[model samples]
Every structure is written in C-alpha cells, then in structure tokens.
Target: MPTFNVKLPMILSLLLIFLALYVLALRGHFSYVAMRAGNYRFSKIESFNSLALNPLMSFSFALRDYQKDTLDLKPANMERLEELSKIFPLFSTTPKNDFALKNPPHIMVNLMESFGTQMLSLQEGNLNLLGELAQHFEEDFVWTRFLPCQNGTASSFFCLFFQSPIVLSKSKYKEHYLPFIPIEVYKQQGYRVIFLTAGNSTWSDLGFFMKAQGADEIIDEVALLQDYPNSSKIHFHSHYGVGDEFMYQKALELLSSAKEPLLILTLSVSNHPPYPEVPILFSKEQIPLEIFDKIPKNTSAILNTYVYANNEFARFLSKVKQSELKDKLIIAATGDHRVRGVAMDFNTEKALAYGVPFYLYVPKAYQGEIVYDKTRIGSHKDIFPTLYALTLSETRFLHLGGRNLLETQENDKFAFGFNAEVWIDNEGIYPRSSNLGYKYKDNQSLLSTEESFALDEEHLEFHKIYQEFLELQLRYKLLNLAQ
Candidate 1:
C-alpha cells in the first residue's frame, strides 16, 4: 500500500515546492518570480489555482508585525512633521467677513464612478456625453487638471477620507486611529457625517472603516433596500447594487429632514462595469464615427452609464437648488479615478490616464473673495483642505498633506500634487517609476520630453522628502495603533 501511494506523495511534494516559491515571489526575494507574481489576479482565475493562491495573499499582512518595529522612527518622524508644518499649516481660520454664514453649510461630496476627463474630452458638437450636467459645469467651478490619489476606486476613496496616500492592504482601520481623518474633523465640529453608497459597503470592509472614522450613519445597498423597498435594482451589474438615482434620492431625503449641519459623502456605482442597463431617464447620445472607432469595444455601454450618472447627478443638484437647503449647502463632486477601458500610451499620456474632473459648487452665501482658478493642478488630498477652509472657523485640523486649493497662490512651493504613480507641479508630470518626466501645456494635453526636460535636483529633493513624509506619517499611525 505504501508503494502504491508514491504518486500522491510526489504531487504533495510538488505542491509544497510551488507554495514556497510563491511566498518567496510575494516577498520579492526573486526578481523574475516577483515580476510574474505581481500580475496574478485571483478574480481572473476560475479554478483550484485561486484557492491555492488565496492563503498566500495574507503573507503581506504578516509583514505588518515587522513594521511595528518602527518605534525608532519616532524622532525622524517628528522632525519631518515639524518641517512639513512650516510648509503646510495645520489650522485653517475662516476670514471674518459677511460671507461667513452664521452656521456651517451642509457639505455634500459625490464620488462619481469612472468620471474621467479623457472620455469627456471626446465630447464634441454631435457627441454629447455630459447631458444635463454640461450646463452646471459651465456655470460652476470645474478643474480639468486634477488627478486622483490612486487609480482604483477603493484606494482613492480611502486617500480622500484619510487625507493620506499610504493605504495599507487588508488592514482594519478600526485598529488605527489616524489624526488626519476628515470624518473625525467634521464630527468634532458638531456635523453629522453620513456615508451613502449605491454598492455594498462590505465590499472592501469600507463600512467598518467608515464607522471607525466617525461616520454617524452608513447607507449602503442593504440600507437603501430596507428603507425604500421599490428602489431600482441593477439588472446587468447586480454586484454594483442599486442605480444612481435611488442613492441620490436617499441623499435628498436625508437633507430634507436633517437638524444639524451634515457632511454627506455619496458614492455612485451606476457608472461602473460591466456596465449596468441604462435607466429610463438616460438620453442616448450620438457618438461620431471617427471618435467611435478609436474607443474600446464597449464604448456604447460605457457612455450610456456615464451619461446616465451625469443626468442623475444633475437631477440631484436641481432638486437641492429648489429646496430650502440651496443657500445652505456646499457640494463638491469628483471621480474616484479615470475610466478603465480607454487605452493610453504611458510614456506620453500618463496625465490623461490619471486626470479626473473636480467640480465645486459653493453656495452664494458662503462665497467669500475666494479666487477660483480652474487651471491649478491638484488631487483628492486638496479636496478636504478646501472644504475645511470653507466649513470650519478657526478649527485646528491635522494637515497630513495638501493645500487649500482656493487660497494657495500660483507660486506656492507646496502647490504640487502626488498621485499614486506620479508627481505633478507647474513643471509637468513625473512618474515615480521613471527617471524622465514629461512637460505639458494647456491643461496637460500637449506633451514634450526634450533633452532639457529631465527631473532637476530640486524636483528630486521634493520627491525624496515627500516619500519620506508619507512613510513617516504611516509609521506614526502604526505606532499610535500599537499603543
């Protein structure tokens, strides 16, 4: 019997060897193995291979125990914090003026899914993508040069909420109480923070994270269905949950009955993929044949969802404007990241790939002498700083990173932006993985990389300091969590 089981033992031995190699590759001990392993996605695999690889994914989390040894970095972190404080001040005191309201306005941040400028740039006379939202964009403040902190939805959401770029994988935010959390800041100022989403909050443990970050209420797909039984369901993309209109309708309901100042963060999922069936309210646009041929195969499906999302948002705004909350609300909307299906040459079109629109609609009552510069380059980090400046008065909030885009001068040295893969400033966009950066003009459409366009010493120094600052901020958070 033992001799007959030789093949079983051989297979077990090979499986053990493969697992060992996978662990090594995940740790990046072998360059070739690491390169190959980096491309592995368990979602794409449809066999026993996913099960085998699943356990190994937790290997990265195991390394977090080693990172707890960063207590020694405290002094260095303190020095960096001091240096950064001088550059980016923590407290934002609202100016004493007539524009300052007697009470803080309700802050509404709508995170539209895949609302990229690259696709919007394709909107010509015949090809209308914006739909009803076009009129609002022309009237309100829309910044085209803005980028998201990360390319993925979850990463960008966390980046904006925490006001930091360092997002730990599989880490429970409940364990770590970061000082830079925007929800906590809003809570401290007596504002009720509500996180509304059209998708399941349990998708990335986002519900738990939002609760830990001081969100007063979380309205997800389950909550929406419980409240409104007749709400629309996502027929095609059931995983994405209800349509955008239902989620926005819930927000309007909350605003109508709110007693306290509110900070409602709405995440719309209708614009995601595999695209949901277009709602009845969506008006289909005619895409030009010339531009149609250049896009991905599912361009029609993508545009339908995009235009639907825009129409829903515009409808939401119109309702808000008609309500009594019109003069008492501050709405800021932006995309989580660029649309995924569009192809871009990374060597030249990196900015276009990362570019998303930042649309701000400040109430006339709250509009001080603030200069609105649509050409300024920024990312998700700057969103809260601008919001804090407008909403809070003389409140001391932690400035983890980013400047107040409204008050920051054009020549401000700290006016640079750091997306996940690139560093953006007045000069151009610099990809972190590459030595050479590209120079652009007219809102990053035209690119040039001449011999004189190399990253200078000053740029290198800024990058070095910024990278270290991010690491220190993360280390400090970990140290706080350990305590």
Candidate 2:
C-alpha cells in the first residue's frame, strides 16, 4: 500500500474535533447515568444540579433516604403496606383482571449460568458474545438503563419474567408476581406457564414463592437428579448443585413437546459459584481448582466464576442459532444482581448497589445489538415489565408498571425506590423538579406542583397502589405468590 501525504494541520484539526466530541459524549453519558433517585425529589433544581455533578454522593443520599420514605408513610398505610408487602412473595398490584394475551408471546429466560460482567464486555470484537449478533439488533437495540435486582441471579430472573421487582430484600429464596407484570395477567387470561430452576427448588426459598404465584409445574435439582428421574448431569458447587446444564438441555426438550406459544423457563447453576471441574473452552484439561483457589480471597473466586459465566452466555447465544427454536425464543438475558460481595467496591451516582444489568434480546425481532449503554439509568425492576411489553403487543402492555424498553426515553427519568427502579427517556421538563413527567410519557405537568403536601399525598397514593398490587398478587397467587 502506498502512503498518502498527511498534512500536520489536517491531522491536528481531526484530533481536536475527535477530542471535543468524545468529551461531550462522556459528559452526557455520565450525567444521564448519575441522576439522583429517592422518595422525594431534590430540594431545589439548584441542589440537584450541584450534587448531581457527583453521582456517588447523589446516590448515597438517595439510598440514605429509602428508610425515610418508609418512615414518611402514614401509620395506617404503613401498617397496611407492610402487611401486604410481607407474607407471600407476590408483592404488588393494579386492579385489572384478565389482561389480554398474545398466546405464546409470553417469555422465559434460561440463565444456564451468567455473570454481570458479560453484559459489559464488547471490547473483544463480539468475541465474547454467546450468539452471533442479530442483524437488526445491531442497529436498533439501544440500551436504556440498569435494572435494580442484581443481588442474586434468581431475583433478576423472576423480576423480568413477571415484569415487576422481585422482593429479594426480604431474604428468602422466593418472590412473587405483582399485578403490574403483564405476563401474570396474561396467565389470568388463560395462558400456560411454568418455571423450572435446574438447581434446588429451594434455592432462595424460590420453590415456595414460585408455587404461590401459580407456576403449574416446578422442578428442582432433586427432581432431575433422582425424584422424577430424568437424564441430567451432576454438578456440585457450594451454591449450585447438580443438573444445572441438565436443565438447559431438558428445557429445550420440554419446549419440543410443548404446545404452541407456551412459556417455559429453565435456569442454570454451574455459573452460580464454587465452579469446580468444568471443562475449559479451548484448553484440553479441566479448569484446575488451584486457579480458583489462587484467586485473591473473595474477589478472585467471583471473578473467575464470572468470567466462566460470561463465556457460558456467549456459548448459549451462539448455540441458540444452531437450534430450531431460535424464532420462537425471546430470551431476556441479564444478571439477577451483581454479586454484592464481589461488587463491594462498586458505587454509582444513580443507585450504586444496583449494578445488575438487564438486557432484553429477541433473536429476530431485536432491532439492534449492544444493548448496553454505560450512561443510561436502569434497574432489575425494569426487566420483567419491559420484557412483557417487548414480547406482547404494546397497547395491552403500556398500562403495566414497567415501560416498553424499546421506548427508552432521553429525559433521564427513572421511577426508582427500594425494590423498584424503572426509567423512561426522551422528554423535556423544566430543569427544576420531577413533574407528572413520569406518570405518562407526555404528562410532565401532571406532577409539577411546588406543594410538598400534594407530593406527599400523591406519593402515598402511589405507594398504596403498589401495596394493593402486592396484596392482589397474594390473594390471587399470581406469578407464584402462594408462599
């Protein structure tokens, strides 16, 4: 190749322009990702603008006030909401019955082992992707934000499936379906549903809650390993026992026997932890235990396992292409939650503890690829509702608590709270406060009042509605709320 003459001035000009643009983009990215969230808006636009510059401080302040919101609840409502929030895992509501259905448009994700970092890995030219890029997804799948439920894998899994937040804070291996999840409502409309965790059904007390919410059939490691007697491989890890991968292969088989439009979920355990003796991708020998042992205490093991899980996601994505159900499968791949012990040092301006990443990938229908946007505000709570909105028709789904991810707005607005965080982008609001801007896409003024009383009142009402949602969920046992 012949070298072209390069002018010093031209090179300098290009460099300057590139530098400027990069700086601008970085500023925008950081700003959007760092917005403050809590029970109350900022004292003033000036306060928010000043602190918002430092996202870490803003998020800390926000978290500090989470207890404040609960405290602010009227004694009666607080008691009512608390009672409704506890007991069954089905934790929320909106009064509507028999929501419409799109037949098999319901979704199920089989997390055959995943790590939070994989979603952030694109540095190696898609070499780490589980599946080849969905051509349409490459251009259109714009990432909106992070979802809140990243503490555990199961939390992220069920949260998105139900289109609402899964109450992991209650410290049980189980959670319930809130009425806000369109998928549960679809089941009310006569759709078939089943959740299969290839590990212990008791993983996280999920077995009890999964049933409370009305999963017709539930199978844990015992069933696959000895109880029901199906072919499965044994895997023994502190966190995940045998039959993790077995669940994947068997879930696929179940799909083969399923009627049209059925929703079947199969989760994995190998990537969960204590990963021992799994084969390396290219190495001939098995992964030596020493490598894992040599990791620097907690971080080293988590990192190694996370890397292994990332590769698994890439493998799963790639494997789907080679299968028959590619078209019918709308896989919502994401982390249940970032392993907090591993992410102990992580902090963000917009809810630092919420490092869980939720990515909704529909093989053929996905309009773009690389759904991760480093600067968007998102949470685990956003996963389920968005997943439902994406799979089913938008009109029917629009009413749900979670917004359609395809419509990720630009205003940097997220509905974030203890177990809930939802964002909608692309809207204009006066620089000062959160208006009704969130209640509806166009109704910015609906919430725009300088009055603290109305803010308090509306907030309480919203809280009440959310409580009612969970209460209804418990009553109906929708989305496995039975426990």
After superposition, candidate 1 runs with Cα above 4 Å error: 1-76, 83-101, 232-237, 279-286, 408-411, 443-452
- TM-score of each predicted structure versus truth: 0.79, 0.53
lDDT of candidate 1 over 300-322, digit per residue (tens): 87777888899989998888888
Q: Give me the displacement of residue 133 in model 2, in angstroms.
A: 10
Cα error of candidate 2 at position 332, Å: 0.3
The CA lDDT at 458 in model 2 is: 36
Give candidate 1's root-mean-square deviation (CA, Å): 9.4
The most accurate candidate by lDDT is: 1
- Predict model 1's lDDT versus the native: 0.71
Q: What is the lDDT, from 0 to 100, of the residue 408 in candidate 1?
A: 36
- State the displacement of the C-alpha of residue 85, model 1, in Å, after optimal TM-score superposition: 4.6
Query: Candidate 2 on 363-413: residue-level lDDT in tens?
Result: 554322223343444444455555554454333432223433444343232
How far out, in Å, is residue 150 in model 1? 0.9
RMSD for each model, in Å, please?
A: 9.4, 23.0
Q: After superposition, how far is residue 71 of candidate 2 from its true place, in Å?
A: 17
Q: How many backbone clashes are present in model 2?
A: 56
